[model samples]
Target: MTSIFDADGKQVPCTVIEAGPCVVTQVKTLEKDGYTAVQLAYDEKKEKKTTAALAGHFKKAGTTPKRRLVEFRYFEEDKQQGETLTVELFNEGDFIDVVGTSKGKGFQGVVKRHNFSGVGGQTHGQHNRLRAPGSLGASSFPSRVFKGMRMAGRTGGDRVKIQNLRVVKVYPEQNVLVVSGSVPGAKGSYVIIEK
Candidate 1:
């Protein structure tokens, strides 16, 4: 994230993104695929690293291999296979949504994950039960732990969508987008921006 100067010389925090010069690799139609969507390929990848089938797929689109491919269902603009799309699709002050994976926090405890207050009082000779999950299940009744329990396991690295972020700036020449506030994922991770 970085700060930018507004017209009033006020500094505004924003996230800079390389929007894209994405290529339309495939176009799915209602008749053929039972849906309408365009598969856009962004970033570059080596032909040797890509599978033969995928390489042929990129070849059919008249473009080199791409690192990421995403399909945008019901994209407002009409695009064809092998067409190039740039950041020009967005303009300053445009409201958009960004979808990306959040940073992984690995395995976390219930205190940090579920915000459970650890057995608060230390008066009754409590040992390390401070950060414990407290209880798992009832001893007899059901005889088992229930499903969908929010225990400490894996966290983060989930798909996150931040909506209604204003487009602060658009650099078509550089294919970059400066949006208000922060975005998901670690640095250099790919994100999908939608109108």
Candidate 2:
């Protein structure tokens, strides 16, 4: 998705996602289901990898198989049994949301992880401490360091949502989606594109 822009007002290259052969597993309406939405099932799974109930659900949809299931909000449609949704529902220049898991960067320091500027340059006998985070807890006045400060622990590998991404291209034939920006996770990771 586009990031913070300069004074000139331009958008960055947002990531594209070829969303689905997303099968309509269920639909929700305001009166009966009390919401407007559709549930989509995607990603083929081995029979061994799926449970019996999920297998039955996909079988009823007449879909090959699926490993992940996702739902869209406030999107309404009358889909027949075994009906499938595809990337063709979107076109070029469409703004959409891309959802995926970010890459995991295990444990890191505040300087590398949170981009905090650590101390100063090593000169005039500054010793070995350069990037070490200094002063976490206050000196007696506050008694303790506040919880949930930007200290580094496990970073990334999070469910990240990039919104307003422009759809660059779609290859429904190969189930390939090319968006404008970098997506989370590796190439094989499954991503969700919502319009």
What are the lDDT figures for the candidates, one per model?
0.93, 0.75
Off by over 4 Å in 2: 1-18
TM-score of each: 0.95, 0.81
Determine which window of 10 residues in candidate 2 has minimal summed lDDT. Answer: 1-10
Task: In candidate 1, list every pair of residues with a backbone clash.
Answer: none
lDDT of 1 at 3: 94
Per-residue alpha-carbon lDDT of candidate 1 for residues 1-195, written as tens digits (9 for 90 to 100): 999999999999999999889999999999999999999999999878999999999999999999999999989978989999999999899999999999999999998888889888878778878888888878898888899987888889999999999999999999999999999999999899989
lDDT of 2 by residue, 78-146 (tens): 766567888788776688777889888888888888888888898888886777887786778877778
List the pairs of residues colliding in candidate 2.
Answer: 14-180, 14-181, 15-179, 15-180, 15-181, 16-179, 16-180
Which ten-residue region of model 1 has the weakest summed lDDT?
119-128
